[model samples]
Target: MSDAEGSNEITTIENPYAYLERDFSSENFKIEVKNLPKFYGMNEFRKLLNEKLKLHSNKIKTTRKNSPYAFVCFRNEEDRENAINVLTNYKWKGYDLQILKAKPAPDPLVKKRKENAEDLHSNKKTKTEEVCSQEEKLKNSTIPYHNVEYDQQLKLKLEDIKKVLKKFGSELSRQNTELKNWIEKQKFLYDGLPCELLDIRFSDTTEGYRNKCEFTVGIDEDTNLPTVGFRIGSYVKGTTAVGPVDNLVHIPESMKVAVKIFQDYVRSSDLKVFDPEHHTGHFRQLMARSAQNQLMLVVGIHPQDLTDDQLSEFKTSIVEYFSVGKGTPAKVTSLYFQKIVKKNHRDDIVPTEHLWGDTHIYETIMGLKFKISPEAFFQINTKGAELLYKAAIELAEPSENATVLDVCCGTGTIGLCFANKCSQVLGIEVIPQAIVDAKENATLNSIENSDFFVGKAEDILGNICFKATGEDVIAVVDPPRAGLQKRAIFQIRKIPKINKVVYVSCNPMAALQNFVDFGRPESKKVHGVPLVPTKAVAVDMFPYTKHCELVICFERWDKISSKQLQSEELVS
Candidate 1:
């Protein structure tokens, strides 16, 4: 039969052995190599397999874009098995290759000739549907531990801190002899620890404890409408879809209501939600902060070529809607408008204009009133913050004769809390606005002993009179999530009066380097006597989430003699 007639006959043939020559058995000769380097040309990859690896391959199949895995086809099963054995866990260009056997690719001609082509198409459809289902699952998985029991979630958080402390202890043991001896001495109080790891503490109320929430304005994948909530993932990964905040357990009901109101307002507005891809449109984000019965709403917009009059009209419409119109039900105490402009760096300051209502929101923690500004950095959980601050203060062990140095003090929350216990409280923050609020907060609470400076802690720590009117200065550092700057760590070490430091870190993994730097041997780059971890505690500031606060107390000790190092006194 001719080729065309043979193809027709194969399509109608019911015999199982029909078209035996087309059975490629490609699966037996193909291997999948994963964990590839992010950037590489196809020719270079082939050369690596052919010349460098001394393994000849017929062809390599890869995605259109740069993928982390690819399939290389050999001529025989022996070569394929050899390739797997050679490349499995093999280090290549700083990455370990994960090699495994791959399934065969269906030949298009065989699929067309087979009468069960519908089955092949059906299988493909099912796989596509499964992929879409997974995307939805990932998009909605904002609160990973929300469904978990509160007790189990707390334990998980505690375990995370324990791991961080354990790794830190190991690093300390390898860094210096004094630190190793110190860890050995402290082993009696806490097992497998460089310091005493205390029981984790948490607030009484765990659910709906968040005081502030920032919601993104973008298209929702589920509803295909404008949404105000969190993004599923990073925008750089092409995931601009915003998931609904209504289902999030950490957000308070007041914040969710505010989100709904703004979402509705944006949907009704003629302008479009700002697209991160094109950087166009008006609405960008909605920030909500609640203090008891009051709620502050800040509307962020991308003014994308809008006229002054148009911007004024847009601002007036939103102010009226939230102030007295349909959004009055939200009882927004403070309303502000901010133009969202893309920044060159993460720390770039963006100003907010008070469109209506109060200029700032107030919160009372530890009986001291704090004035919170829109741009100021405040803890998301209010009740949880009280527990966190309490733990930090306890670890700090403030005394009337000692001064408390509050580094990265936002609005003087921690410093003011320590003012009654310590002789004086000195705070340093980078944000000028937060410093303004900190001074006003001091005045509001009649906290006369505390003084806040407006500059980076590294720049102001040496210049400021931290040693004024005190026998000892305890540095209480509660820096941002990224941890303390190297210069700030250097400055903290240089000060001889700072014998004790209470380091509060929300992200202990990120702050591990800071902790290590404190105990590093004195060098030209790092000066002064080193401090070692003495005690640490975990605070469950964010329940139903993988986040918690870790407070570690670092203290200085005298160097031991070589004779003492050999004696039992070394463990003491």
Candidate 2:
């Protein structure tokens, strides 16, 4: 039969497979194919299916321009099954085609209505619980700590850390079993090294270890009075009532006193607590940062249609309460009035107006002074951060002639730590203010061999054209919780000079994927090289919480070519 005739015959063939009545719906019979060639149009994809797999499609749907996938609907399940059986793992245009049955799209209005109903129900339940809890706590009025219970909580946190690390190690082993076995067989730096189950770095002052707290400004559930604290639950989880943190064990005594004083001041004033649900009111949130006996306060207010004079009056009232009050328990080092939009809680792009006091606060880590802006990212546990940075620097093993590259170097804390040991340090960060802080920090510490650039790790690392200054170059990456991007991995691999990589990750589960991207042989094809994991250690950055930091050292398998190495030696 002619090809055209065969296509017509296949299109008209009867589907004899038994299918559910629901399968008659177009959604049930549709299959989505992803990772198709970007250049493939709907007609071209359909023709390919027909010519290659001899399967007919009733209708073909293409995504927007330049999309890499399309949808194919068959008349019955038999043809869909055949298509999946034939094309699920088939390579097309140098990429594996991913085919899956499309899930039914829900009606937007129906989904929204259901969500709203659920939210209403949850809010009511949460409010009732919060009221009961608040009444009970108020009646008791005593904050006591039980050693047994505290020990149990600490034990549980350690167990959680172990489980997370175990899972992370298992995932790495699974992804690169050969590498794991090779490290075990060979005398790697970490092979046979004593692996501590959990290293306890006791906080110098456990009661007030938290240097910062963000308290929501709302009415107390029991008293119906304006107060400052955390909400009973999340706003989306149906919690509208604010719970007092006066007796919260983690907060400092000074912070508790400041919060209580602020609550009283707000209650006496005409300001209204911002309602997240209704998106109304004025005072939204109180962000307090404490460092070395000084406090920085950022009062997030809506400033809804308030005149400059009115805003000035409000600011004056706050200053008087905190600074000039009869019995002020806390010294206000810096105060900021941040105008916040109710809907954009995650937006840090908005600027904060300076109201009073110093513009920045200084925190000393490992004898290095770091100037922190209100918007700058700093490790909350100051003492714990020292341990974390020490672990990363130790694993980095920066030689006297080595140049260290610090990726996502927030405030250049890690880079500054190793600046004295290394020949030179180069830091990259996305935030411009963070870069400024990093430079300031380097200068404050009198570390003259360090430089910081304001750009993403992926962008800057990809375009890095400089040669290594010494025998070996080391990279220390402290990426955010989302972990390193694929492009960042590609860039890291492209730099033949950087043989050792010290990855400091806050989230190991997310970092596991990055490990796979860095060390797996499959990734070598894209980047032309792969790194081998040498050693990893977990630091208890957050003792009470389930979070911890992992530091892994990866070494490149392929060194620079002979001529490049000779040239690098000569240059050094």
Write down the worst ten-residue block by lDDT for model 2.
Answer: 14-23
Clashing pairs in 1: none
- Per-residue lDDT tens digits for candidate 2, residues 1-572, read 99999986543322211112332344467788898876544444666888767887766766584478778877677999988988888998788999999764433333443456566777744333344467344323222232235455456655655565455545555666645654343323322331223254445555667788888898787788788987654543434677788656667887887788777777777878886543568888888898997888898888877899998988887877777783266677888888887334244325887888899999999899999889888987888789888887877788899988888888999889988888988888999989999999998999988888889787887444263467577889888887877678878877778788988888877676777667666443456466766566666555445566777787764442344357769999
Candidate 2 matches the true fold with a TM-score of 0.71
Per-residue lDDT value at 475 in model 2: 87
> Which regions in candidate 1 have their CA more than 4 angstroms from the true location?
1-141, 343-349, 559-572
Model 2, clash count?
0
For each candidate, the alpha-carbon lDDT, in order, equals 0.80, 0.71
> What C-alpha lDDT, on a 0 to 100 scale, does residue 237 get in candidate 1?
36
| Residue range 449-519, candidate 1, lDDT tens digits | 88889998888898765445775889999998878987788898888888889999999998998899898
By summed lDDT, which 10 consecutive residues of candidate 1 come out lowest? 15-24
